[model samples]
Target: MKPAELRNLGIGAVLVALAAIFPLVNDGYWLSIATTAMMYIALSTSWSLFSGPTHLIALSTAAFFGIGGYLVGTGMSDYDTSFWSMAILAPLVATAVALLIGLATLRLSGVYFVIFTLGLAEMIRNLVSWVQNNFLGSRGLYVLTDFTEAHIYWMLLGVSVVVFLFGWWINRSRLGFALKIIGNDEEVARHVGINTAWSKVILFMSTGFFAALIGAIVAPRYSYIEPNVVFSPQLSFLVVIMALLGGTHRLWGPLVGVIPFTLAWEAISVSFPNSTTLFLGLSFLIIVYVLPDGFTGLLEKFTRRAAK
Candidate 1:
């Protein structure tokens, strides 16, 4: 393995060790906070896996997430399936949906791509809402909530680690090279014999599968699943902001962005309550102007200057 890979393994080992022990000393409140942070990390990194390399702006995070949650919720309620069974099934469903959507929309780029993705998510959300209200009853579905907070925390941690490792693997693989080429110039990539569309479709489906898996496993932590809550646009936007704030070009950028911002989000939400969204919006705008490449890029610049 390369030195960078070794370093990443060492760092990941330390983080896994620390996360494993966190529930031992932390209270339920802290454990919940940590779990939320881990969930955001997983979501953002999974999102970065596709959007970072391809430069496609997707707002379907909540769509996949909500679909996974609903799959679990409905499966358990309608068929009495176990959590593990639903967890395995949700990702498959998400992958199918992503394949269809990616194939349809991969041809669109730039702002048009963004709008279509966002529109697709909203359409799904509304369809889900209508179904629940008409057939499934207006009330939200209840989840099996027997698992302890520690178990949920560990699950979240595991998902985060898996997502992170996948990002690292892709960034170092030949697929990453192809993505960079496509991102730079899709026409050139095609001229050079790269199958850009299929590459994007594969990535889109892969990321969707993981994002759905995370949501599937995490769904049971909450006692209830509602379309409006799970499919909120804000949830999608949060992942985008997290990835952007961390730096999209590097595998580790989302992790770096998620940690501090998750903590700050918790604090800001508590302090401002009503105005928390406003503050977050302003913060994102400021970061775009000040650190266009994100915190990871800034750190790289600082390290180079220090070395000089």
Candidate 2:
């Protein structure tokens, strides 16, 4: 590995080590806040892994996430299956769904792709609700488990670590090079012999897998999961905003964005619960108008000036 990569890895390790100490030192509301932050950290990072390189603006995260939550909910509540078993199966199911979606939709680009992805969660949510109401005789399922907030936090942190490492590896691999080329120009990438569609599908599947895994991990926290709650469209927008706010160019950028944003969001949810949607919209506007390149981009500018 290059010196820069090694340095990044070392910094990431230290940050993870410090984060691990949070639960040990604090079990109050802050611990819960930290856990939520870690969840977004994982989600935004995983989202960036594909969207950053491909510039696809996928809005289907909630679909995969809800799938995982519903799987765990149904497995534990209806089938009497173990939480771990559901957790294990969730990603596989999500990956399969992603493959199907990717194959069908990856060819579309620009606003059309974005529109399809945005609609996917709503479509899936309505379908799930219908299935539950008509066939299952319920609007939701219970996911009772002994896992506490701390356990969930740790699990999310572990997933975040793995994702970061995986992203780091991808950044240095031939696949990453292909993605960069594709992002630059898909036509050029095709002309140059890159299988752009397959490359995108692979990354899309990865994002789906991680999102599902995370949803499964957090299912117990919800306890009673309804399709509407699990498949909330707000979650998708939040992940996209967080990833973009941090600057998706770097593997660690999303983490930088997630921490501050999560804390602010928590405060907003507590202080002005009814106005969150308004605030979320405002935040996106600010990100687009003022910090289009994100905090990482701003930092790079400062670094360049200092160097000069």
lDDT of 2 at 229: 86
* Per-residue accuracy of model 2 over 39-92 as CA lDDT, tens digit each: 899999999999998988989899999999999999988889999999999999
lDDT of each: 0.84, 0.91
**117-197 per-residue lDDT for model 1 (tens digits):** 786667888998788778877465778768887887888888888887777777778787889899898999999999888
Worst 10 residues of 1 by lDDT: 107-116
**Per-prediction RMSD in angstroms?**
1.5, 1.1
Identify the runs in model 1 with alpha carbons over 4 angstroms from their true place.
Answer: none
Among the numbered candidates, top lDDT falls to: 2
